[model samples]
Target: MYTVSQDCTFTKLRSDSTLRVLFSGSLRLKCKNACCQRWYFTFNGAECTGPLPIESIIYLDQGSPELNSTINIHRTSSVEGLCEGVKSGLVDVAVWVGTCADYPRGDASTGWNSVSRIIIEELPK
Candidate 1:
């Protein structure tokens, strides 16, 4: 699921400027065994593309039935990243998951017990 932050809006003092994007917060995530959960950022309806994008990949290995182990339905955790070279303008910042369904996707939960946040800082260079 993509968590779109409509509240994130900023005016760039210049045209075609760069921005430092960071998406950090807590979330409960779970998926099939050997499946990797990828966390990425999107700005103005476009995925952040570059040599350095705001994305986090966490490889999780859990659940053993034959060993009498219980499967983790969802693990609660947080993510953090700092991506540069993102074009700045009248845009919307969003957080999205990629390629989860292709790898036996499960689900992600958040904004229930805590208030997550995103920050978009304009650098003065």
Candidate 2:
């Protein structure tokens, strides 16, 4: 099960300005069958075109307690287009935690819980 702890929405920003995106979340693995799990923060929608700026991949062990992780990205990197879209009001900023099983293949079981919080802030250029 996945839960959103905090969702932050920002007004349209200036396209030429720099910004910072922060993704923080906690995950707990409850499945004994799951050998390993990986988590990361994705930008925009899950299906957005172009390359998505993802945070560093976090690996977790099965039956592990709640683990907290955070990823920080700037607007000038590979996610410039996304930043521009947010600035132009054509897109909104959102953060989500995505996880996948690493050990068993073709396993459709769901025995994990996660909570995520996203924050977007504009920085002076």
Candidate 3:
């Protein structure tokens, strides 16, 4: 669990203030045919409904799709979205990621000679 904010208080956000989440990372996925990965930020343990989630669709090598290759490729992606209608006094912000694809025999790794980051900011509403 990643800590987005820690002001030593639960009420870090006010009703007049709005918060947004940003995720930046590189994903390494093995492409057999095609794969679509979904990523989203969770507000204090629940999925945020304020902004659209991130979607990454990767296809097999155009040159060869039936090759039984066991290699993974790296793709960098970033997503930033607002968290609307969130409950007040929430302190912890989390991130969620999952893979959905046919014949999902591949694995995803976020650590590949790169650092992942998550930033949360408060804005005046």
lDDT of 3 by residue, 8-42 (tens): 22345576666776767786656555544445566
**Mind giving the per-residue lDDT tens digits that candidate 1 earns over 29-67?**
555455556677776667666545676655556557478
Off by over 4 Å in 3: 1-11, 51-66, 101-105
After best superposition, candidate 3 residue 42: deviation in angstroms? 0.7
TM-score for each predicted model, relative to the true structure: 0.69, 0.46, 0.69
lDDT of 2: 0.39
Candidate 1: segments with Cα more than 4 A from true spot = 1-7, 67-88, 100-102
Residues 5-101 of candidate 2: C-alpha lDDT, one tens digit per residue: 2345565457665446665544333343333333333334542233454443333344323543322211111112233233434434554334454
Query: How many clashing residue pairs, candidate 2?
Result: 0
lDDT of each: 0.57, 0.39, 0.57
Q: Score residue 34 of candidate 1 by CA lDDT.
A: 55
Cα lDDT for residue 114, model 1? 57
Error of 2 at 6 (Å): 4.9
